[model samples]
Target chain A: MDRPIGVMDSGVGGMTVVREITRQLPNERILYFGDISRCPYGEKDLETVRAYTIQVAEYLVAKDIKMLVIACNTATAAALEILRERLEIPVIGVIGPGARSAIQHSRNGKVLVLATSGTVKSNAYPDAIRSLNHNFEVTSQACPAFVPLVEELRYKDDIVTGIVIHQALKSHMHSDADTVILGCTHYPLLKESIRRYFDGRKAVIDSGYETAREVSSLLNYQRILRAPEGEVTHTILINGDSSRFKYILRDWLPELKYDMKEIELKV
Target chain B: MDRPIGVMDSGVGGMTVVREITRQLPNERILYFGDISRCPYGEKDLETVRAYTIQVAEYLVAKDIKMLVIACNTATAAALEILRERLEIPVIGVIGPGARSAIQHSRNGKVLVLATSGTVKSNAYPDAIRSLNHNFEVTSQACPAFVPLVEELRYKDDIVTGIVIHQALKSHMHSDADTVILGCTHYPLLKESIRRYFDGRKAVIDSGYETAREVSSLLNYQRILRAPEGEVTHTILINGDSSRFKYILRDWLPELKYDMKEIELKV
Candidate 1:
């Protein structure tokens, strides 16, 4: 019951999920792995993403994690099922949580999903939404530029970031959809611009927030929730250069006290 | 795997949860039991609520339900732990789902829970919220009149309904809490008036909605989600007169096709 949760993503984008878990379930420990060296799994082939995901999962499993969360949309689209089959712990993905959030928020029964090209190609969002209720309609758009913007920490540059977001969303801004799903983890960094694009008319969902709530529900259901009196600790493991990842970690979690280490993962 | 989910309530209040499960997971079948003869368990003692809940749960279990949902807050506060200990199938309550939702929406880390007298007395919401994060501040108010308004079908009497809601919430309207939880399943029927009382300043969370989403997440996690191609059905069983319950059912779910029956419960 005291085992730490393992969270992995292609890069620091997954820190969004980490922030939620820390804020929502403060007593539980977390082990985060960012595959920065092989970052941008969004453009990789399904087989390659699955291979990289399984490699990182195995490493975390050996270290004794109670659960596994695939924070990368592309990686989840490629590897969620296979990981659930191979791993004994509970395995969760971003797509189902995002889709469920969209379903809950949509008033017009129309949803728009914005994700990396690889996730869009996999049609995971549509499948997830339709599987819940076929009456709900889905539209997907691939934002190939969004991940790089977040990875390079250029999301804070409002002028340049605004242009990139506008270029990707302008065509769909006037669509009939009443809810937008931030299907990729990196997309949350650009949420303000996306909300502005829609002029605050539509509900914008952050998958990390929903995924964090799901984690809380599942932990409580399984009776593995850490007691509030326990001391909380966080360990972040990066498989690539640590300089930029460290910078973003500090910016996103300014008050967080955590230990960061550079680890070489065999994949 | 195709077994119907069993939902029980002290009275018709739980129809709100059934409505959500029907909307969110359209493929799954549901069997609802409303103990109308022993209605309004909110004013009853913990021992009495637990005894009544166990009697209903036993009847449902004999029918072979895959899961049991305690859709009433009072029943959940009293019998949730005991039911989990005794039942082999998964048992979920509304309190945890509501608490998680308030945590997700509260910007100031302060939440207000509006529930029945029994739920407030049990302190389940505060405990559930604090168990997840000690930083959260929870305040509970026992709205003893809210259930009567919903059950007697007087919620539509805006003048009378408005007075009752205003009297209950006027004192806490100026509090630092940024989120309001409709902790009782019956409270959602009064949502519009409650929203107006706050002047649209705070986030209002409906426990039934969050509970349905958790049900969906758990079902998916356990790989027991019914396929979309399967037919969906609903059955309502009442232990008392069905005249008013029938009227409310038609009013709340106009398009929902279902069957209703009157049954005598031993308890």
Candidate 2:
């Protein structure tokens, strides 16, 4: 029960959720797996995404992770339920928390979700929201360029990020929805660009923060909350070293120091 | 199409919606009716609330108003559909817009809806939200003391309103929800207090702004948009003069000046 919580995503993007878990539940240790070799899962078919997610999840579970968190929306939409049925530990998905967060703040009961094409094609958010409150109107757009914008740290270069974000969300500029969800885990890195484009006209939400809250809630309700006085440490593993897991995380979360390990994916 | 838009609420609380409309659609003229004598309709039963809303809507229709807006959530919950069916002009409700806004901004997918016991009992927001996206998790709590808190201008005195708001929302302090809906029209007046209590953890959305955006969208879509170049004037009417309509309106929106007329609700 005191084992580290397992968190996995397609790439360094899952760091967003990792950072939140670190902030909200400081006492808990984290075991994060980034399938950096697969990199952008958004472009893959459902089966491929699921396979990659399963591989990463299995790796984390073997490491004796107590809980599983699908930090990437694509993986959640593709593999969460299956992993839940297959794994004994409690499983959490980014989409659910993000969708929940978006629903909670939208004043018009209308929402604009910006994820990847795979997520949009899967109709993940709409389906999830419909199951929770079928009366909400959902609009989703896939931003193919966003993940790169964040990974390259282009978001820090506002002018370029703004252009990409505005172009990605242009059609829904004056959408009936006055709130936008950074549906993809990586989208949180593009938060400034998203906020600047909406310019106070809309509220922007993220799954990282909400998912962290959920992790905290689940931990408490299940009576597995780590002791506050205990020393907490975290581990990051990447399938390949092509991705900048440490550099990006350190930039966004300079407060935490983490040592990352590079591991091989059997497949 | 050039005629004034009709807006009504059980009391001056609906003025929040009116103010939003005035700000968002500056060129459109508004004719608002507040049944001040029947203030605090949150305590009334559904049938009575429905009847009161019908009468008010009818009165506005009789005024040659182009569009009808049920600015009170209770009235909208009780009568929006029926009135929409009965009236030829477009009908709008505060609840739908508020729910939409809340859904759009919530990061946790959990929403805390604060309204009068009557509005909460009517289940208007939940119904409307469910109609759009059933996946939302909604929590509705009625604050019987909120209307008076705003009407008495207690919010201006943070020390007073903060205490009242904190007490009202304390039970849901760590609610799974990361967003709060100002479910009642008057609750917009209590926003700062509500925000302060939640700190920055949750987004506080007001139906007033959402309703205004909806009105604007409806006008454009219905092709009833008034020419911006035309001279626009507004009128406010209350069933009783005992209410402090002028003082509150002027205090909140000094830029808007409109003559008031006294009317009566037969029942």
Candidate 3:
């Protein structure tokens, strides 16, 4: 009951999921491992992404976490099922929850998924939503440029961010989807621009927020939810220099500031 | 960093504050002691309220909390300053944050505070808001029956709750207070009906939410926030049978399920 929740992602983008989980489950401690050394897992091959994800998951499981949350969409697309099968604890992913939330908010039966190239190509969200409701119209738009811009903290520069969003989403601008699922956790940081671009016509589904809800629900159903208790110091690990990881924590979640530890992944 | 946060309330209404604190600072464990044996501190004399408040405060202080939150408005009105002066850790109250939030949200310089009779009589919010800005119009309405309705779980019954609200605020219907500060934590539970009664014209300032933010800011500024770490189970102690407390927890926050311990207060 006192074990922390384990979460792994490719890079700081998963911090969005971390932030939501913190907000939703404040008493539960988080054991986060951001594989910054091998980030851009979204651009890698299927087997490579799965291998990297498993390595990180194994590290978190070694930490004796009560549950596991795959905070990255790309990793979820590649390795979620296998990780669930291997791990003794409950495993959660962002794609299914985001799809479910978008499905809930969508009025026109039309939904769009904004994700990394890997997730879009993998058809994770499309498959998840379709399996639940085959007739629901789903569009997966890959904005490959979003990850780099967000990582560089260029989301603060509205002009450049707007241009990138416009250029990337130009083809799908005319589509009348009432809901847009932010499949990439990083996209929520650019929600204002995305909302403005659509003139507030579409409801942006932040998969991170939905994923937090799902984790809480899953833990509750399993009767293994952490009881609210003492001061919990979250553990953050990276397989590289902690400098960039530190900057991301301050910028995204100043309230949850903590030093990141360097770890050897033996890659 | 692993010390618990002390929260003292007159009765179950402050569970609303506990709920927000749990949501806002999920990683930090809460040490809550509700005086269910002598609840409705709203009806007590100032000195009596102060004594009871101090007793609970001292108990929590002994529990070695890093900070203290006065979760009840009546108790805050009566004993916040004394408690702060007496305690070594940072101590916070619901009134100031609610007043500040109301001032921030109000456009017409018109604000109404819905509080228990004790708080209204003490003029806690009006004085707090006006002390910051002298020209702002402030009205404190005494919802004498609200606490009981909420405590008895009558708020779940819309008909009685609606009639009680209507009867309580009949005279203020024409008054254009664009911001309604929920001075009593219990008032948040009745927010939907209150909003509907006002036809969504007034923005509800949930003091509990604002108080949670204040606690976070204070802790962050003081550099005393609990680092997110190992599992932490919150300690909840009530000065009487905990059957009602359990029911309220389930009703108000189903996601947060934990056992409440019964304790002797010797009031």
lDDT of 3 by residue, B4-116 (tens): 88888977878788776665556678888889999888877888998999999988888898998999999999998887678878888888778766765577879988988
What are the TM-scores, per candidate, against the unseen true structure? 0.98, 0.55, 0.56
Ranking the candidates on TM-score from highest down gives 1, 3, 2
Per lDDT, what order, best first?
Answer: 1, 3, 2
Q: What would you estimate as the lDDT of candidate 3?
A: 0.81
lDDT of each: 0.90, 0.80, 0.81
* Candidate 1 residue lDDT tens string, B31-55: 8999999989999998999999999
lDDT of 2 at A71: 94
Candidate 3, superposed: residue stretches over 4 Å from native: A1-195, A201-267
Supply the TM-score for candidate 1: 0.98
Tens digit per residue, CA lDDT, model 3, A1-267: 888898888888888988877765566788998888888877787788999999888888888999888999999999988987898887888887787666555767789999888898999988776644455789888898998888777889989998999998888788998989999888888988998888888898888877776665455434575665667689898888887778767777999945578988955
- lDDT of candidate 1 at residue B236, scale 0 to 100: 87
TM-score of 3: 0.56
| Clashing residue pairs for model 1 | none
